[model samples]
Target: MSERVLVPRNRGFLFLDSHPAGCRQLVADMWQACPAPAGVLEGDGPVALVIGSSAGYGLAATLAGLKRAGIRGIAMSFEKAPTVRRTATAGWYRTAATAEIADTAGRDLVFLNGDAFSDSMKEQVADLIEQRFDGRLDYLIYSVAAPRRTDPATGAAYASVLKPIGQASCTKTLVFDDEGVAEVREVETGPAEGDDVEQTVAVMGGADWERWIDHLAGRGLLADGFATAALSYIGSSLTEAIYRQGTIGAAKAHLEATARNLNERLGKMVGGRAVTSVNGAAVTQSSTAIPGIALYTGLLRGVLGDGLVPPIRQLAALWDQLTGAAPLVLDDEGRIRLDTWELTEDVQSAVAERWETATTATIADLADLDWFHNEVQRLYGFSVPGVDYSAAVATDIPWPDHAP
Candidate 1:
């Protein structure tokens, strides 16, 4: 009889597949990257709630605030894919690593898996906040991105669409070739329905943030001098037709407006303020998937690597503003503006010139293509230092503090 070989179950898809050692290593890395300042909140400090804290800039914000402020308790909501394959989102790995590090450091971290758009989830979250911290929260962060949302009142679903403002348009994009020059044209799909835009606003906008604040305040679970912030982005006009003028852009505008409303309402409660940080554009998982952006990002990455300002640098600056190291500047729209620095007149002019007169010969002069490709890879947790690619990673690897 032939001997049978058994294959280990693939569980990385369900969880982050994080090991205690890896988690510790990650914490050590992050600590070294951004060390805590003296006299900051320390030793089992204030509680922070991060909604949509699974991936992208949201995860980055969570890490930044946690490290800077020495926050000890964290509540996070993340949507995970249900599958048997090893497809853990980056946020899952980050949360697992954070929980492990916090446990060893004598901190408190709670992670909840739920749909943030649902009412039941909000109630449960409110209950958790009241029960855990004696009705007091110090900080709140809202960052959510979704393709579609169902209307609570109408029982109808809305799907967001990306397109130009007036009519159909085509744009050039990057393609893989030996010469690093290829043209991929894209057409604007069309405008989404008004209801669709409204639904998208409801799901991705500040409604959840407001709910969190209202519930916490009504329940007397908010600490003194609390602060809340949400992230916003305004891409360049070249891509704005498909981004800022589209359904998603409408939702963002609503989110920004909601932040002001919350600031007015929540400010009176605990001497608090609600602010929105205009963040930089990067090749995040969400941003890369948007049409025409990958090409622009590829170009931008190349240009920014040569002593030019990049979005990550902008994020660092945003953190400085949040920590009171610098002042935040606002535009006429009552929204924080950072994209102006990123898509400056000179930068956009240069990219436009390149776009018009670029060919195989012009591609080399555009910028370092290699840097652009690597940044995209880094977004997926690849090409990061300290990770061993040679060894086979286990899917059901145990986190340091995972109960099960």
Candidate 2:
């Protein structure tokens, strides 16, 4: 018998096949769904500078800006390139696929792969903007998720940790193996230790985001009437201790605070506005790493099935709000809320009820664990339908060439 080929696996995460066709299909569906305002100019559209624009909300926002606003974009990300032993990260293929579509559609897209937190990378992107797309950008999307960061000036490394604030808690967490077996494991998380919270804030917080905007503004790269949005999340009370009220939560609070600060500064300086777009939770590379998220997502699916909004859908809704299709609504804190429906009372009530009674034995019945599993794999570009898994794929793919 011929050897059976399976999706490549690393560290229990199955990296999806980066077949150009499958990537194209995913982009096409999202692009078609994004509603562009009528009478948008073809060649004179807005320009967007998207930081961390490879996966999840970043990728979705990029597609929406392109398809709906007819905007040109420059995407910056830090993703792994394919090695001799394995395929590239899903972001690599997703970016390549988006570039291919942009070419066929005669849209402008430029992707730069590097450390978004670094001063040099920011400088490079600024230079690219000034040289290629004039000296101004209309939109800046920040959606980076990373565990550690190195300060460019100080060379200090900070790592983010996931822990509750007050005390240790024992919870039921989900673990997936290479063969895709889902197992519930009991996890005990302790409180953040000395400097843990501050370190996490330093790494995952708004400082870097503020720095990026400042850099662009200093260089005259922000256009008049420009807008910038950062992605944040506030899930159900089930994850309050570990997520919404934990170290990460502190970082998010800082992010929102930064948004308000930037909103004031940008409005005064360049007629720009900054807002935090509170997002809904879905299976993504970052969420699965949370201790109890798999269980919660499964329960969430059982409640919000057919109504769960993925990143792509969420971005399209955001576009509508930006273009006035929907009212520009903000939470009491002045943050844009795309998670309105996800956090509705009815949805949370249902999820809470299921969450209260859910056990490992009862999870299979109360939650759509299978659906969550597939979605997790899909985040990495695996399990996508119509993509031939057995076909040989190119490990090395180049970015689309752009002329100055």
Clashes of each: 2, 0
Q: What is the TM-score of each candidate against the true structure?
A: 0.81, 0.93
**Per-residue CA lDDT of candidate 1, range 1-404, in tens?**
11112122222112233232233354446545554554556466667777766466666665666666555445565544313644445455556666655665555667776777666676777777677766678878777777766555466666655545555556665555433334445434665644656666766677766766776787787778787778888877877777787766877788888888977877787888787877767766678667777667666655666644444345445555555656766666556665665678887877667656545456556745666654554544444568665554543432234232
lDDT to native, each model: 0.61, 0.79
**Local error of candidate 2 at 249, Å?**
0.4
lDDT (10s digit) by residue, model 2, range 1-404: 11224464557544544444455566666667666656654566778888888787888888877776766869878878766555567788788888877777677778888899899999998998898888888888899889999998899999999998889867777666776666667788999999989989998789999999999989999998888899989887878888888899999999999999999999999877888999888787888787777788888888878888777778877776765657778888878887877788888898888777776667777788788877776776656777787875555776656664
Best by lDDT: 2
Q: List the residue pairs that clash in candidate 2.
A: none
Clashing pairs in 1: 135-221, 136-221
Segments in model 2 whose C-alpha atoms lie over 4 Å from true places = 1-6, 14-24, 33-41, 177-179
